[model samples]
Target: MSTFFSDWYYLSIRSIKQIWRPLLALIPSLFIPIFFFVVNSSSLDAFSKVPGFPPSITYRDFIAPTALFTAVFFSSGNAGIELVQDISNGYFKKLLIMPISRLTIILGRLTEVAVQAVMQGTIVVVLLLLVGVRIQTGVLGLLAIFAMLMIFAMAWSCVSMISALRTQNARLVQSLFVVVFPFLYLTTSQAPMPLLPPTFRLIASYNPVTYIIEGVRALVLTGWGNPAIWQGFLVATTLFVIMVTLTLGSFKKALR
Candidate 1:
């Protein structure tokens, strides 16, 4: 146990040191959401008044959580990209021969991703507050939102890691975000469910991102105690487990 933790710590620090470049690359992830927040709030201000929209929340408030999730989903691709670089440069090969556990290598990278996600989530929260979006869930809700973001980030990182380990190609790992963007539009990111077309609504119902958005939305627009919050937690947790299992399998394959 001690050896595993020590390996995790060493790899985590290496990840942290090298993460700044990826964080810089991901700056657009933070700004694009804020940009959309302004545009959606301005253009859709009246849309909230339409029947079926949740009462008492501005469009800005409604969309803030969605924006945060967007940043998270996009920024998470960096983990795989970093892993690919390590492989391409032969650092990963060197690590494989070390006495550390393979799982720690993956966990270390994920730990850094979680930290970055928390930071990005914090920036989004601060920006949302600056723009007049209030958190109905207060301090505890803020913590819950951060926790959820980390879970989501970790799960997405696992997906990214799988690609990195399998392909060992930076370009391919980076391009995974292309696959992620469509899900944002298909989910309830920009509007509520009732406003969506029947087909889109059906798709969104099955999209796990939908539950994640709803969960974060509950913390920001409603309260942490809402069933939607727990539902989102359950969905994110399940996804995390499945993704981690796949990532471990991939890591094992990479070891050979």
Candidate 2:
């Protein structure tokens, strides 16, 4: 047990360092979300006053989660890219042959994602605040947002890592990630659910990201007692379990 944890600790440290070592690679994850936030918030500033939109919240406040999440989701892909790089450079196989337990490698990479999520969330939060966004749920709500995204990032990264493990193609893995990002806009991102077109609303209903974003929107604009608040955490937790199971299964196959 001690060995397992110690191995996780060391491996996690290594994985965490690899992410920070590339400044250029990390810049887009940091800037793109802020750019998204600034553009969307400004262009749609008038929409917050539109009927059926949530009251007492600007478009900037309503969309903060999407921006924060953009940072987290995009950065999570780096884990898979790094894993593929390790495989290509022969480092991954070396780790596989080491005395450390194999599962630690995945867990270590997840730790790095979790750390990156928290860091990215913090930066985005600070930037949002600088531009006058406030969380209705206050400090506690902000902390919960961080915790949720950190878990979500770890869970989401598993898919990317699995993709890398299967194709060993960084471009394919990244391309798929980019393709799926538009799904975020399909949700209640630009306007409240009531203001959305019926067809789009129906689509958003089945989208788990809708619930996650609503949960975050609740934290930002409505505070607790909003039933939708717990929905995001539930979805994130469920995804974490499913994705981790698949990742472990995939990891086993990669060994053979």
By lDDT, the best candidate is 1
**Candidate 1: clashing pairs of residues:** none
lDDT by candidate, in order shown: 0.85, 0.84
Model 2: residues >4 Å from true position, as ranges? none
lDDT of 2 by residue, 1-256 (tens): 9999999999999998987686688888889889989999999899988888777777888888889878887778888888888888989889988898777889999999998888888888889889888888999999888877777788888989898888788898777676547668788867788988899999998887787788887888787999887888998899989988887787665666
Question: With candidate 2 superimposed using the best TM-score fit, by how many Å does residue 217's alpha carbon deviate from the native?
Answer: 1.3
Estimate the lDDT of model 2.
Answer: 0.84
Model 1: lDDT to the true structure: 0.85
